[model samples]
Each structure stands twice: as structure tokens, then as C-alpha cells.
Target chain A: MTFSDIPKFKLKEYSKAPELSSKTIAHKPVIIVGSGPVGLAAALDLAQKGHEVTILTAFDFIALGSKAICFAKQSLDIFDRLGIGERIIEKGVIWNIGKLFWKDQTNPVFQFDMLPVTNQKNPGFVNIQQYYVEDYLVDALEDMDNVDIRWGHSISDIEVRNDGARLDVDTRDGSYQIDADYVLACDGFRSKIRDSMGLDFEGRIFEDNFLIADIKFKGKAAEQRPSERWFWFDPPFCPGGTALLHKQPDDVWRLDFQLGWDIDREAVLKPENVEPYVKGMLGDDIEFEREWYSVYTFQCRRMNRFVHGPVIFVGDSAHLVSPFGARGANGGLSDAENIAWKLDLVMRGIAPRSLIESYNDERIMGADENIRNSSRSTDFMSPKNEQSLAFRNAVLELSNDYSFARPFINSGRLSTPTPYHDSPLSTVDNDEWDGGPKPGFPCVDAPVNDNEDSNWLLEKLGNDFKLLQFGGKAPESDLDVINIPIDSLAAQRYDAHHGATYLIRPDQVVAARWKEAQADDINGAYQRAIGAA
Target chain B: MDKFNDTVNISGHDDIYQMIVDLHADGNEEKSQKINAKLIIAMINQIGSEQIVKEIIEMVRLNEEKYNPRSSTH
Candidate 1:
């Protein structure tokens, strides 16, 4: 949407703490450090499971810019569980195709479609401004009675004890102290909690700077441009650098121009300087208005560990990556989903505390994959040395003629859910199976007829431990079991010949699978999945 | 006479030279030499032409002899 058209969310001031006295400290079950997408999602998830959650945000309002515009399908599915997926889809710009171009080339070097299937609930990707996402999440969070969101309350210091954490908060009324059973640092990239705790993120910071500009171009010319991700390597419009174009809602277009290492930052950001670049890309005929602009340099860095005793980190506080692959926000959302259920289980004493360690283990692997992919894309887009440049040029040149060279073209590898194949929580496969989600992989959605109504297979699984029995009668168990006929799509996706069963986790990841289900084997797998054994 | 009896086609000479300069930008002579040696081996492997590699070696040897101050030709 246009900058003026974007709704400005009002920031409210929280009242002074009631239980904060010299002798008594306000105690909470859980305290989330930020009210952004990750923190809000985590709060909603935990609150839905009957846990009391307190969210502490420094500011009352959402982000100003359309910062993270691309949301992957996996994140959308996670949002679906949080009850905001449909609304986001309704307002977002959905597209699956990405076209990559070489410098001044009339034809695209290569093109990719993220998802070809139209029967799916969510598209491959959607472009929605970050502020709108936060606004919707806030609305969802307000409906839950168990969630307490405190605005204008900033943490000045943090003491992470073995049992819990005590935070020093500053508010407009007065400074107060609050103790929490568990503390989550969702404070984003420059996390004050992480800094106060002396935690450091160790990784590489890229030297190149990119200027991101959001512009509103309406009328006939704007309508003529296709709604697809267009990436150019050293385009003529932005000579000697890279350029990216994406279509956002409300006639607002996002443009990213790569500026080399040595440039006058202030001079480059001026409207006078940026106008020529925009004009060159759109030509002299089209008219546009600058909505917002910012200069940023990205880094691929993450904390060594997400969990530290009673305090834990999630989202950007735990990991940070370049925005090329749209992994920054999507990865953070995954972290929230991963941690919420595990923390809930641990808090309820349903699982051992060690179960939370898997959050660190699995999310770190996910962050590493994102970092590697984004770093490679960055290197390809902005080659550090001559050899890499040569290789990139060769790939670009050959892609024009040879189909084999198209695969070598390195634009941003879009975000995908990281399959936790090596996670200790998953039961190892013991039987032969065909195409389907294996252990530690996300469960694929399939259309199913449940209770005489057409429903998604994922919807039937719900938010708890369940066993899917295919091609046979479900065995008796305390856990919920769904029986699908042999000819069903669910059976085919599970590769069930007669009696295949799958144990699904609360977050909808396949924990274990087997050709046949036994009570002891199923119990053992369930126990292992929850870290009881 | 063919200067090097080379069958391999080399393009982007200036880019290659700039790359070499960039590689040595740190001013580490020994490391640069080692990197150059590794690069030569890698290029030879990529070219996959033993005869062309041999010719290149012979050309380098002759150039070294011609430039050597103590040689009779000098």
C-alpha cells in the first residue's frame, strides 16, 4: 500500500505495575520481550494452550515500513494455526513465478515457479507489508484472555537466574521489576536482552549496502507491469550494481538497488539522487511518487545457543540473515512455532526440560541452511573477487544458450521449510516406503472426507499428538487416531499399503512412521518424541 | 612459430589480471604464490588438455631463461 494509505497503529501506555513494591516483585508465568510477529505468534500459541503469557514491548506501534513483504507457504500454514492465515492471504499479493535477468538482456535468463499446484490452501509466496502482519497478530492476541500485552514497557536490564529471570523494566509512569518463570527474547536483531546477558552472534557481515525504496505508481503503465518477482544482475537502469522489483498491494512497488561498498550514504539516499535511478528503470513516461526509502547492510549471524537456563531467544534475537531469500521473517515465525509447543509441553510437565533443547538444535540447523543459501546468493549478486565474478558472468552468458547452465544461475534461493531429518526427536525409519513425508519432515496436506464433510488432512490432525492409521482399522490407543481408507489421497501420500501409521507432533511434523502399528512401538516413539526416554 | 602451441581459448584477460591483483591485495607474498600455484593446477584440471598444459610449462620455462640476468642470452 501507499505510505499515506498504510494504517497507523496507535501506541498505548501501560499502567504502572501493581505488584511492584520494594519487598514484592510482580511474578508472571511467561514474559515475551517483543510484540512483533514472532513474539505475538508465540504468545497466541502458548495462550491458546491455556498458559498465561505476558508480552513486553518497548513501543506500542508496529514497524513503519513494508519491511518483509514475501511470506512463504510454510509460514502461512503456521499463521493458519494462529488464526490469521486467511486474512493475510486475502490482503496479500500472491505470486509463484520469479524472473531473473542479466545486464541489459531483453529476455530473462531463467524463470522459476515456486509452486505449480493450485489445489493447495496457500500459494508459494505472498507479498504483504510487515506492519499489516503485526497489526493482524495484535488483533488476534487481544482476543485471548490469557495474554497480557504491555506497551511502552522497555527492559533496561535482565538477570537470568537458574530458576527464572528477573527483568528491570522502564515505563512512563515508573520503573518496576517483574519476575517470570521463563523469559523469551523476541526483541529482534539488536536484542537488548541478549546484549544484557552478554550473548553474541558469531557470523559474517557483508560489506555491500542496498537501498530499498517503496514507491507508488498508479495508472495504465503500472497496470501493464506483471505481478512477479523480477531480479536483474547489473541492470542498465542501475549500472554497475544489481536491481530487484516486486509488486506489492495498493499500487505500491518495492525496488532494491545495490550500491557498492564505497559510496556517500547520505548523498545516495536523497530524493534527487534516487529519482534518476527510478526514472531510468521506469523510463521518462511513467510517473511515480516515493513512499519510503532506507539503506541497509545485511549480516548472516546467529547466537551459539537459543536457550540459556530460564531465558531463551527466538526470532531475530536468536538469528539474523540477509533478506534476499525472504528467510528473515519466515525463519523467525518458524522459530516461534517450534518453541511455543515445546515450551508449552515443558511448562505443563508433559515433557522433560530437555525437549526444549531440540528447539535450539533444530532451529539452529534451519538458521544455518538459511545463512548458507542467502550468503551464496549475496556472493553471486555481489561477487567479492574477480574469479567469482568471472564464474557468475560465465553462468549468466551460458544461460542464454544452454539449458544446463540455467541451474547454475544464482538468484536468491527462496525460503523453504527446513526438514529436521537428523533431529533426535524423530524415530528412525525401519521399513521401506515410497514418496511421502519421512520422519522429522512436515506433514503434507491432502483433501479428505471426514465426518461427511470435505476437509484437509492437516486440519483433522489438530494441535496435539495423533496417529494416522491408513488402509486398516485404527488400533485402540489413548492418543487420537484417524483411519483413512486404502484408496484415499491420504493413504497414497503416506505410502500406505495396508497398515501404515504415522505419529505427528503438535507442530504438524512427522515424528515417526511405520508399516504396522503396535502399542509398545507407538508408546516408545511418542516417549522419544517428547524426550522422556 | 606458435608462441605456446596452445589450443585452449582464453577470454577476459583484463578481468583475469584484475583478479590476480585482487588476490594479492593482502600483500602476503608466500600465500599469494601458493594461491597462484593452486589456481594454475585448477585451471589445468578444468582445461583437461595435457598437451596445452605442457606447452604452457615450456613457454614459462623459456620466458624465465630469457629474463634470467645470469644466462648467456642475457
Candidate 2:
């Protein structure tokens, strides 16, 4: 079905607007701005952890855009933790292979499997409309009584006080004041909070514009086509341009064509202009219908600091990368998961407030990685000077023939989880581990037998600190412990040769691991993970 | 003997060297320079190792200093 066929989900109006309440200012523990996927994910995460959250968004209904269709495996795992993974995986199209073509060649120069590591709980990537993700998060948030989603509420002004943050929220009828201990700005790239605070989002802006046309194929043609990402450089359809095609759910195909720097945006977006490119790629005989079309020039800019006093930036508000890598929403979800657990601990007084500082350090590293990758992809696709263009063309030309030159052909580097190996919260490794996720790396998932029934290692970890011990009994401690047999798949994936023990953080990141677990060392690592050390 | 020990990889040595020599055949200095620049970039990408590339760059710089001394604007 097309976008027009789907009905917008109108949010229920607040029974009593915060402005109309008796109190001059309503106080909340955590207030998240914008109800997009990132904001909603953060809200659901905090609420699931038993933290009271208030979501303030200006839109009363779900936005009708097919924005951010590719959700990576790490993001899907995050969604699984947030209680929406199964539904999304069921509805979304899963793809693991991507093919890159050069010039007029119908055959691909190279194809890559996004998931080099096999047998994980989630697939390499899922292509679902961003609205569905938002809807699922909102549905999960609505089920909890602790989450108060204030629709039609927009933050006009914010004050970062020594104690907390005070937001002047504007509604359709009136405005209200909300004093929140923390404010999460998941609002997209032009974040009002970032602007009001006078924070600089500095980075490189790419020079080419891409026209995105999400089209739905009619009849059996859609099902017959391969469900893999296909990218072309200088094809017969659009010469001297790059084109990308991704298969979304409901037979919807997202087609992006790089329109040169100097072109009429309005003229290109017109159906007459868009139809030619579509027909050129899909051929003249195929039947199709346009769902959505947009022209966007992406920038790789980000705030130097994501955390400012009582207010914190998440998702697009924190940083933005070019759309080539599909890192935008996926990276934002990581940010949400990163901050949610820290905030949960801080709110419960289980961890010190200084733990929140690690969020800045880690997510900034993640953002910089995304920026570096996307910027290189952008430079490869749209060379700035004649010399660069010659190099790009030389690579493309040589890649068609030589196997060695194919590695230089950069269409785009797909998004993956950026490991936080240098995080301050991670305890340095003293044990000699030949394999397995190192400190601050996201834990690997593997199949294991739980009481003669099959189970995934990641799902069993839950959203709290756990001790994954292999072939040995962990010492008595308050932390949850899971013992795995030495011959198990998880043991092999984790490279637990001789009774290894791992200290996993609440976000499923390996804080530390040891050949042998001692009570004092385990406690010290746990303390360091929670920023107590 | 140490210089000729040849720890570095130069697989398909003669063919690759011939291709590089052929690139300058009957070409002007400007065209040859452009070809060299592109070739260097492509080779660097082929190398794919920052440490090795840096070592190669330093070796080339030292060779230029020893063999081709800089002459003043005379």
C-alpha cells in the first residue's frame, strides 16, 4: 500500500494540559522532546526500567514519511530490548546482501554480505518505514502508566539550571512550564534546544543533492525482484550520477538518484522529472506508483558536546551524518540505549551522577566514527575537484576488470555498530583473551540451550549487569549469573577456552572479562562500570 | 644485501613495473604527473595499511633527500 492509503495515528489529547494544571510548574524526572523513533525509544527504555518519563512533541499524529527505512542489526537488538523487535522483524523486509554496479554494466562489480558473522539473534538489517518503528515505540510507551506523552506540546524555551532543566512548553491552546531533572533532545537536525543553548554543530557539508523517490511496484514484479540493496555508479539511466535502490515492506522500493549540484530542486521533484529516472532504472514496461519524493543535501555536522548541564542531546540533535550509510536512525537508537541505562541508574541512585559523563564520551566516539565513514563515502561519490574525479573514475574503471581495484570502489559503507573500546567506563584487560568482545565492545549473541530449550544469549542477559561465566560457578554476588557449558556455541563465540568470566554492563557492553573471576576483582569492575570507581 | 632482502611484497613484479613504465611512455610531464598521482592513490588504497604506507612515504622522502638534493632558485 502507498503512503496515502495508511491512516495517520492521531494521539489522544492531554486530559489536563500542564499549563492548565493547578501547580505553577509540573516536575518530572525525565522529559524527552520529539516523538520520533529515537525519542520514543529513549522514553520506552526509561519507562521500562521503572523511571517516570514525560514526552513532549509538537505533532499530534504520526508523521507520514518513509524516512530511515534501513534498521541495522544492532538497532534491531536494541528494539528487541525495548519490547518491539519481534513485531518490527515480522513486518519489515530483511536484507543482508548489497550489490554495487559500475557504469552500464548490468552485472555487479562486487557483492557483500552485511553479516559476516553468522547465527545471530537478529538479521543484518531490516527495512521498515520509520513510522512503524515510532508507532511501535509509542505503543509500548502508552502501555506503561509511568510515561506521559504530551502531544501538541512543543518546547519554546529551556533553562539549564544548576538543579535541573525548566522547559517552557507551548501547546495549541496555551503554554506550560515543566521542571525536569533531565531533558533529552531527540528532536531532529534543527534542534530547538541546541539553538536556544547557543551550541555549535560544526562539520563538513557535502555538495551534491539526492532526489529520493520511494515507489511501490505493482503486481508480481515486486516479489520477483531480489530483496537486496543495489547501488549503481554512472549507469545508463543516470550518467555521471549515483543511484541506490532498497526494498522496503509492502513492495515499496526506495530509489535515490544523485542530482548534480546545480539543479532546480522543485523541477526535479516534479513527477515528470522523477518518472523519467524511475523508468530509466525500472524500464518502460514496468507498472509502478510513486509514494513519496524528496530532495535533500546531507551534512556531517554534530555538537562538540552532547551533554550540557541538565539537558542532553540524543539522535540527530547530537550529530548528523550523510544518508549514504543509513547511520542516522541506527546511530540515534544506540544513543538512546546508551543514555537510557545511565539515566536509569542515576535516577535510582544506584550509580553516581558522573556516570552520565561517559554517555558524552562514548556517543561522541560513535558519532565521529559515523561521520568519518559517511564523509569518506560522500567524497568518493561526489569528488570535489577534477583530480579527485579522475581518481574516482580511475578506481571505478579499474574495478570493473581488476579484483584488487574493487576495494577502492566506494559506493557507500553500510552502517554497523561502532564499538566503544576507548570508553572510560570500561576496565582495561589484564587477562589474555585471544577472541571475544573486548572491554566496551557490544556483546556478541549466540545460541545456547536453556534447560534443554533453545535460547539466545543476548535475550537472556536482559537490561542489567550480568556475569556470563563459562564452565565454572561464579562467586556469590548480587549480580545475575549465567553459566554456560564449555562446548556450547556461546562459549566458542566468546572464545571461553578455560573457564572465562565476563562482566557485562546494563547496555550489554562488555565492561571487563577475566580468565578467572575473583570476588574483589568482580566487585571492582562492577564499580567501575557504574562509575563508582 | 640487506637492501635486496626484499621483505615487501611486489607480486607480479615485472608486469606491474612495466605498466608503470608504460604510463610515462610518450606522455608530457604534466600528464605523467597526473598519472603518477592517481597511481599513488590507487596503490595506497591497494596497500590498505596506514603503517606500511607511512613507512613507504618516509622511505621515498629519505631517498629524495639523499639522491636529489634541493637546488636554490639559481
C-alpha local distance difference test of each model:
0.84, 0.87
lDDT of 2 by residue, B1-74 (tens): 11222276558988988988998998786566567766876777766777778777788888998999788677
Whose TM-score is greatest here?
2
Candidate 1 ranges beyond 4 A from true positions? A1-9, A20-23, A116-118, A449-454, B1-74
- Writing each residue's lDDT as its tens digit, candidate 1 over A158-184 gives 998767999999877778899998999
lDDT of 1 at A409: 74
Best-fitting candidate, scored by lDDT: 2
Candidate 2 lDDT (Cα, whole model)? 0.87
- Cα lDDT tens digits, model 2, A458-512, are 9877588999999888976789998888888889889895789999987889999
Task: Give the i-RMS of model 1 in Å.
Answer: 8.8
**Model 2, docking class:** acceptable
